[model samples]
Target: MLVRLIVLALGIPAILALQDGSPWPVREFRGAWIATVANIDWPSSHSLTTDQQKHELTSMLDTLLDQNFNAVVLQVRTSGDALYNSSLEPWSYYLTGRQGQAPSPYYDPLEFAVQEAHKRNMEVHAWFNPYRARSGSSSKSGLAHNHMANRFPQYSYAYGNNLWMDPGAKVVQDFILSVFRDVVSRYDIDGVHMDDYFYPYPVSGVSFPDSHTYSAYVSSGGRLSLADWRRDSVNTLVHNIYTTVKSIKSHVKVGISPFGIWKPGHPHTIHGLSSYDSLYADSKKWLELGWVDYMTPQLYWKIDPPQQSYPVLLDWWLQQNKMNRHVYVGNYASAVVTKSWPVSELQRQVHLSRDRRDQLSLGNVFFSAKIFSHNDHRIGDLFKSAEYSAPALQPEMTWLTAPAPPVPQNIHASADYRIHWSGDSSGSVRSWAIYRLRADVWELTSVLNRDTLEFAAHPGYYAVRSVNRLGKESDAVTLHVGDITVGVVGKK
Candidate 1:
């Protein structure tokens, strides 16, 4: 039953009220990675049909929506392949039973993902591992003969059980850029994301055989050392991708989640594999140079660990954020099931992030999304009940420009006390936020999707504002409530 209200002289708060001492910000990034490689997160298995795969994805998104998650980082290009249509690469073996084979009914997962995520008012970031040729086992022979790895053997190298595109080669960089540009130009994604697999995690007993490429660079009068040259190669790709994505769609974001520890002794006490030295990824320099829109270091450790303290590393990353880009902490939710980490471990991490509100440390992204559906250790419930109970707009990027939509019109009160307004058809408006006057202030009651044109009034002063795809809110239109007769309804 809707509660009756008389006009109050006091003003209500303009946002979703902080109900339970919540330290959450009005704008925060809450997302999860939906890994599709080797069926780590989606499809459960490669044997599922198209309808079944669709059902599993829908259910995952539904779970996130129910838990109030606002974004999804979906792995589309897992290992030098495409989950969507592509002329450059073959179909992902994890998506179908075999590589180079299309779904029986033929559907593009990236397109379907963007459409479904938008319907739920969730942003979908298309995640790709730019240089990985194959993971775990050699799929080189299985890959289509026309695949780049097959066509251009000189561009790739085999190390351990994996195949990788030599980062030192200019031709390889151009090929990778073209593949990603194809996706960015065709699909309507919110962001382009990549994981920490730069130069591939070091494999013992065998080194990445890039000597030929390095020798070529040296013969061409390159000045830098081998290590610096490798970092420069990745840095060039990072800068190129950032510029290319913005050139195509300025509002779309570019994010990278690199290895957590930058350098062991940089923090004095912390000791771990150096992302800078071993992986040749200069994540710190990237932030200092403003090459990325956001950075998520995989801070997959307990808060008070002796060496790899989560808080200590979090602060270190924050200080390195010279560009003031969004720095989301990469959390390991799958560890809860695999390592039996207490559910409270996740809660403490969330609290630590909120408590330390530095300029760069904004929000979090769970490792994989599947565990949420299982309710493993009640991790999902803890987040929903505590930190994420209130809704938040995706954190804004002031560097990108987007037109603020015009205020919605035709605000009127219906005879049944339901408020109605004219829907914006400009295709920019993503949803409408309904604000109600309470305690003399306006507070957000609901964020109605664009299709929802009317809202049942709660017998109070109301205002509606349009929110754009970039999470920018428009000025609101007001609708006043008056004396009306309405019947009471039973409680659920």
Candidate 2:
């Protein structure tokens, strides 16, 4: 009889389940990649008007927000061109039809993306391709006069249908570093991301044509072999980028999405192209050295394949995290669209990652965002109904040191059942968490942006808390409500 009465008060079996210790306010990094090169994802085309471009981006963000994703890895720099305004590099040919053309009536895409994403309580990570100077399809005649290839022809060479800047040159490294510094200092981005394009992927039997740079290094008394020298150059840049970004903004995360397989036969069953030898990336060393805040290995394979099995590779990557940084598995959502892979395959992969969350397998990032926009095979619907049915906070990085924001103040409920609150004066709060009590247990109902101070409410017990930029939550301020009056229940 007591149990029945408790159930009646709770009003639902789901609320009762919370009393059994089901986790509330789940912490996970749900992210997606938004590629811009060749207009693969956003803008749909380079020739769209500024308003059309803005609408396309906001629409995509709305879709992700609806599905409860927490982060977006947006490719801001592709092939030495800028998606946003820049004096150093040309406007991306992929952003406007011409290589150096800005949007009609000119609005910075990165700035707009950051603002819109924050309004939706989602993170925007700026993605850069480090060494590729020009993609294969880009025409030399169409290259902007100020493009890196045209300005420093001596440092760039054509290889495998693309123009690549010499990674071994000191000038090239300094230039890339400048680009990183420029973006970090300018935008309020949550993270700085680099994909697996450190050195261009190998071409069949074609050398990288860096003999001139290599000869200079050898004359300067460098003793490492060709392969080791290449790897060392990449390592130096990776280390410098990590330290540089931290020096500028310690809270900003530095992440890398290296190719899935570190080395063929790493786990005794895996076999694939070796990013270490072929691409000169040394990604495993970067993680071991604690240079990255998170590592998103593009483990874009099926679960059952013995050679490049998703679970097998995922386990190996987790085991390699001696520094205990985050490892968010990168899924190939485009595969479901292009190759007709079953949606269940992606779901099973997500379940596998969740199964190992205690081991630092914290989340998943899809390869491209267009899959969600297209809703191919109903992937968006399935994820919304299953893995992303509830809202989640981005997993906290414990290494980051920031004091929690002050608790929300003046929390009141009005006659219309609307809740209102005031944020801290320090301006450190990034979001607010609203929690409601059911069956004597508190459950997080929503996380809203800092600027949003009110929400529709119901006649119930509620608590409001402040969340800081570092993902730290402040103590709660509670209110008990009725049809006519709201009573303060004090802090939690």
On lDDT, the leading prediction is 2
Which residue pairs clash within candidate 2?
Answer: none
Query: What tens-digit string does per-residue lDDT give for candidate 1 at 1-492?
Result: 243233333333333455443333666789999999889889789899999989989999989888878899999988788899999888988888788899988899889999988888889999999888888865477887766688679878887778888988898889889987999999999999998998978888778899999999999999899999999999999999999998888888999999899999768889999999988999999988888898988999988875999989988898898888888899988889888899889889988876665565778999889877777888889888877776666877777779976677777777788887887878889888777766555666666778888998866678777888787777766766666344433221
Write the residue-wise lDDT of candidate 2 on 1-492 in tens digits.
000001121211122123446543357899999999989999799889999999999999999989889899999999999998888899998988888898888899999999999999899999999888888653467889988888778988888888889888888898889899999999999999999998888889988899989999999999999999999999999999999999999999999999999999999999989999999999999998789999999998999989999999999999899999999999999999788899999999999998888888889999889898778889999999877777777888999889978877777777677888775688899998777777777776788999999978776777777888778877777766654332433322
For all predictions, the C-alpha RMSD in Å is 4.0, 4.8
Candidate 2: stretches off by over 4 Å:
1-25, 439-441, 483-492
Predicted structure 2, TM vs. truth = 0.93
Question: Looking at model 1, how many pairs of residues clash?
Answer: 6
Candidate 1, residue 357: Cα displacement in angstroms equals 3.4
